[model samples]
Target: MENKFKKITSLWIITVLILFVVAIILGLLMRFNQGGNIKLDPVTFYTDMTIHGLTMIGIWFVAGMAAVNYIMERYVRTSYKANLIAYIMTVVGVLMLWGAGFIGKFHAGWTFLYPLPFKIMWEQWATPLFLYALLVLGVGWTIWTVSLMISLLKKYTLSQVFAWQHFKRDAKPEVETPPFVLISMISLVGVLSCLITAAALDFLLLTEYYSNGGFINDALLMKNLTYFFGHTLANEMLYLGLAVIYELFSEVSGRPKWKTSWYVAYAWNLTLFFVLFAFLHHMYMDFVQPETLQIIGQLASYLASIPSTGVTIFSILVAVYGTKINWNLANLMFFIGTAGWVSGGIGAVIDATISNNFLLHNTLWVPAHFHTYNALGNVLFSLGFFYWFSFQLKDGIIKDKHSMLKILLIVIGGIGFLAAFYFAGADSVARRYANYPEEMASGKFWATFGGTFATIYLLGIILFIGGILKRCFGFVFSRV
Candidate 1:
């Protein structure tokens, strides 16, 4: 009989794949209509994009956390009360959000920014529906978090080393906090701040006080909280993904012996502390926010990025030094993905510079850098992890060569498309618009070229999805 824990992991992976494909399709189409000023297509645009973002977040980050929680629980033999409930809530919450957004019944983005509901841009029920979905999703996430932590506490028996020490060297490191826990802690704060931000917005909606001149103040407050959560969540994914990559790579290659493990962990922990304060970078272009706030944000933003980038590059080099590195598809992706991440980081630092932000804000440059760094960087690592785990499963089955080829094509095509977008952005193209003006003809040309590559990228996705289906239905359930 298969283990219950293994079954959960499999389910989560399937969920992640469905969400990933949805996100990719939406991403491509959104880029395709880059020049049009269409807010909602009145049918598919708002809901599809909203669901795409939220579900991708849940599947990629939230569901990944669920899997991690399950793994930790299994390691510690934790109880499973409400475990099934947690999964159910997550699925249901996503569906509700999708239905609301797609059916034209509601059209809020995943962020559901302030003054959204009071402004009456969409249906009256959108606010309530969104709040309900939040309630359901939050419960599920809280369950997973509590379950994992309590189980770990029992296993460690009040000792900080075993309880909170996510990584240790020499098999007896003397620290209580580790990078994983610190990231988790930061994520908790991010989530809470977002929730509070949502609550504040909800209050305005209920009272309709925005027409009474509360909009500006509320917007700023909400913006502050939103950016805080947004920046931290994005940064946390990179740090966590890097940690996982370092460990997995070392284990696979059998080198470096985990000597620098604590330093890497410490880097992530301290780095996030700086990330929280860097929220002001988003406000660099805002008119009302104080100049001091912007300066503080820029400083924190630059300071935070240093440790993460430093730890990742130096550690990977030391780990791989003098080793006969294998060129498996997954390993290749990891190495290239790291490079993409670093490139994005460079763009990010530049964007945070006050003068640069003035020129870059609201331009394609912003999305170009972020998509390259967070979407491509973090998601690519996650994909690598998926491939690695498939091979590592006790079933001992590996993805076929056809699957590997598809992944390679997708990576190549996607990067080409994104690079073009970056160039367009640098040339002062704006995002979220459907049609380019004559003033930006050259930029639009390159952007269209990039969009063409994206359409081709979908072909690679089809191949990858087909391979997965074949493996699960034809091979896994077939007679060995």
Candidate 2:
């Protein structure tokens, strides 16, 4: 069973790295086009954007899930079949999605907001193909999530799973929950909720498509549901990586394992609740959206970020401050990744503010913040796991001579690439433009700058992949 699990995880790492490379290439192309270094038709540009955005989100989300599933084995008996099924379905779904975008020319953006998909500027079958692709991915992920939750429940009672005993002041429970379990349970609940939203959103979309104008849908409700699914899932995936960090960061640093305390439990539980309403911030620009929701969105945005970030950062600081800790590629990645997450989160909170949202809406700021967290933040978290997991399969951390070089290149490249976006956004450069107009001539320069740095980032990723990929392949093919 252990060997089988390793094989499945190895496959996931391979798939994720390959897709990540492709997505980065697509992103660089878009940047170059905006810089006037390359010319792509508007349709083609949007098509690439659709696939790139969705693929990055999809791959990274699953990367976190795969890591969590592997680590969860320490505490509970996760279903290998569910993991296998999700892997197969994700591959098929991604292929169908790419077919819709690349072949069918369906480029309505990743959101595929209501009415836009129905416009049908592409192949007649593209819309249904895209929706069905989402259906396939959603169903598979939902099952995997539920299976993990069930595995936890089988060993731990509901209260134990949530670490509710910590809530009672000074009370000691016979079975203390691991910090990993508490965070995982919290993140899984959020994940499950948003996935259900995705299912509902896709169902409405498919229903309207088949109705052929007989059944019109509410545009406002659809937009609400869209962001609810997209925004929430994106955030929850980050928490999943954080879960892995709680489980492995200490061990990697040669420190004691983290345990769930009252504050830890309280913070995660609060995160689960506030994150649900935080998506309301995305609707701030829509006049049709209720003012009450807008206010809740802003408040929830602030509240949601505080609890988890505060506790996690405090914990990390205490663990490393003035201590002679074992520093390796894995723990270093986790440390730096936390910084990136916090930095990007601050940017997100700024944009979520009503006053700031008015100015930042639809500007390059949108991508600037998200890319910070994703490219520099969550990406590092999973990379740490990948590196550690690879070495673990060999029973110890194998010193890599080029580890520092890989880290340096990624840091330099990622910062430079993201800085271009931040600077452009501050200048009020609009996003999603295939080419910059003469008035926004500076946008072209920034795009070129970002593209150059992105190349450096890609080189770093390639180097890291070169090492991990070989080990993963070896493990999968070995007869041990």
Candidate 3:
């Protein structure tokens, strides 16, 4: 079972890295085009944007899910057939998606915001094909999440899985639920909700597309549903990475495992509730959304980040602050990853505020915060897991040499890249523009600079993943 877990995980890691690199290249091209370093047709640029967004989101979400599924098997049995089905479906979905975008020239942003997909400025066939691709991926991922949830329930009851028993003082629950199980369950439930919403929205879009004037979707509702899935998945996937952290952080640092307590239980439970409404923040400018919901969005955004990030950071600090601990690449990645998550999250909160949203609406800052969390935060979390999992399958942190140098590259590069976005955003650089006009010349310089630093960041990822990948491949192919 352990060996099988390893094989499946290694395959996931391999697939994620390959697609991630491709997405990075597409991002670099976008930057270069914007910076006047290179020029791409507007259609080509948007096509790249669509694929880059879709691929990055898809790969990272799967990476988090894969890690949790692999780690969860330690406590409960998992369905290999479900995993295989998801694996196959994901590949097919991605292929169909790529064909639609690249071959058929679907230039709609991965967001595929309503009315725009129907605009049909691109190939007529691209619209329906693109929608179907989403259907394929959504079904596969939804099944995978539900199956994992079922696997957990088979061992532990719903209340136990949620760690509701931990809420009471000195509560001796008949069964102990690991923090990993708690977070994974919370995240899986969120995924299921968001995916269901995604399916509904997709159905609406398809209905309108096929009806040929016989049907229509409410634009506001579609936008609401879109961000609900998009924002929730983005945040929930981060939690998925955090689940890996809760499971591995202390263990990798040679410290004891983190136990589920009242506070931990409270924070995650609050997360599950509040994050569901945090997506409202994205629609704050719609003007048509209820003012009450907008208020709820701001509050939910704050409450969600505060309790969850606060507790996680507090736990990490307590575990490492005065202890003689094992600090390897794995633990270091996790530690630094937490800092990145908090930093990016703070930025997100600032933007969520209504007053601030009025100023920063749809600027480079939008990408700034997300990239900070993703590139530096969630990506690091998964990388940490990959480092730990690969070495556990091979050498147990034997490749500790030049670790500081690698960390240095990642830190310097990430900070540099993000700084560009921050500065450009503050200067009011518009996002998603293929080329900046003479008025936004500074945007060009920043874009070029960001691209350069991102290359450095990519170098660090390459060097770090190099050995991990070798070991993973070896493990994947090794005879049991």
Candidate 4:
């Protein structure tokens, strides 16, 4: 069973890395086109955008899911069959989606926001095919998430799984819930709910596409549902990475294992509930939404991150500060990823505020924060897991003689790339335009700057990929 898990995970890591590198190039191409260094027609540009965004989101979410599924097997029996099913479905679904984008010329900008799919801007058949593709991926992931959650529940009741006994001071429970288990449970439940939301949204989309003017969707409601799935799922996947860090960080650092304490339980519980409503922040620009809901969005955005981030950072610092422990690439990635997550979390909170949203909504500020956390934060977490997992398959550490140089390149590249985005965002650069007009010379300059740094970042990722690939190849052929 362990061997099976390792092999599948190795394949997933390799596949994800390959796709990720391509997506990064697509993004760089888009930036270069915006900078006027490359010329791509509007249709082609948006087409690349659709594929890049969708592929990045899909790969990272699965990377997190794969990591958790692999790690969870230690405590609970996992369903390898379901894992295999998800793998096959994901592959087929991505192929169909790619066909819609590349062959059918469907370019709805990844969001596929309401009524846009019906615009018939691209091939007539592309829209429905895209929706169907999402449905395929949604079904497989929903099943996988629910199966894992059920497996966890079978071992422990809801209260036990959530570590609710820790809610009280000086309480003793017969079963101690690992921090990883609690977070994974919370994140899986979040993922499951959002998948259902995605299903509902897709259903409405398909209905409208086929209704022949008999049905229409409420734009506001669709937008609400869209971000509910998009934002929540994006964040939940990050939590999945955090779950792996919780389980492995202390051990990798040669410290005592992290235990689920009262504060830990409370913080995660707050996250589980608060994260559901936090997506409302994305709707702030829609004047149709009630002020009350907007207020809720701001509060949710703040509440969601404060407790969890505070507790996790505190725990991490406690584990590291004034203590002697081992440091390796995996733990270093987690540590640096935490800094990135917190930094982006701060930027996100600022943007979530209503007053600030008026100034920053739809600006590059949006992508800046998301890219910060995702590119630097969650991506690093999963990469760290890949390094750890691949080595496990190969039975020892595959020493990288250029470990320091690798860290330097990644840090320099990632920071410079993000810095360009931040500068562009603060200069009021709009998001999603293929090119800037003469009046927005700063936009073009920043686009070029961002493209250059992103290329450097890509180089760093390539180096890391080479290292990961060597171990992955060993894993694929190793008997273990």
Q: Model 2: runs farther than 4 Å from truth?
A: none
Candidate 1 — which pairs collide?
34-433, 35-433, 35-434, 35-435, 36-433, 36-434, 36-435, 47-101
Number of colliding residue pairs in each model: 8, 0, 0, 0
Off by over 4 Å in 4: 478-480
Model 3 agreement with the true structure over 1-480: per-residue lDDT tens digits: 467778888988988888998899999899888989998999999999999999999999999999999999899999888887888889999999999999999988988999899998888999999999999999999889999999999999989999999998688888888999999999999999999999999999999988989998899999999999999999999999999999999888889999998889999999999999999999989998989999999999999999999899999999999899888899899999999999999889999999999988898999999999999999999999988888878656556768988898898999999989988988889889999988778999999999999888888888888878888888888896
**Model 4 lDDT per residue over 1-480, tens place:** 478888888888988999999999999999999889999999999999999999999999999999999999999999998898899899999999999999999998878888788998888889989999999999999889999999999998999999898898777888999999999999999999999999999999999888898998999999999999999998999999999999989988899999998999999999999999999999998999998999999999999999999999999999999999788888888999999999989989999999998988888888899999999999999988888777776556635557777777787888887887788888888888888866667988888888898888898888877878888878788766
**Inter-residue clash pairs, candidate 3:** none
Model 1, range 1-480, lDDT digits (tens) per residue? 234554555556566677777787776666555534224363355556566667766666654464344434423565455566667788898877776676535655666666554455666666667767766876776666566556655644443422235445544555444434444444444444444544554455445542455444456776776677556656655654664565456655545434335566666666646877876898887779887898899999888888778887887787677778654555555666788788888888888998988788877787778778755577666666666655544464544576566766777777878788788878888764555678776566765677677767677766655544334333344344
Give the candidate number with the greatest lDDT. 2
**TM-scores, one per candidate:** 0.83, 0.99, 0.98, 0.98
Q: After superposition, how far is residue 11 of candidate 4 from its true place, in Å?
A: 1.2
Estimate the overall C-alpha local distance difference test score of candidate 3. Answer: 0.92
Instruction: Please report how far candidate 2 places residue 149 from its true position, in Å.
Output: 0.7
lDDT of 1 at 99: 60
Collision count of model 4? 0
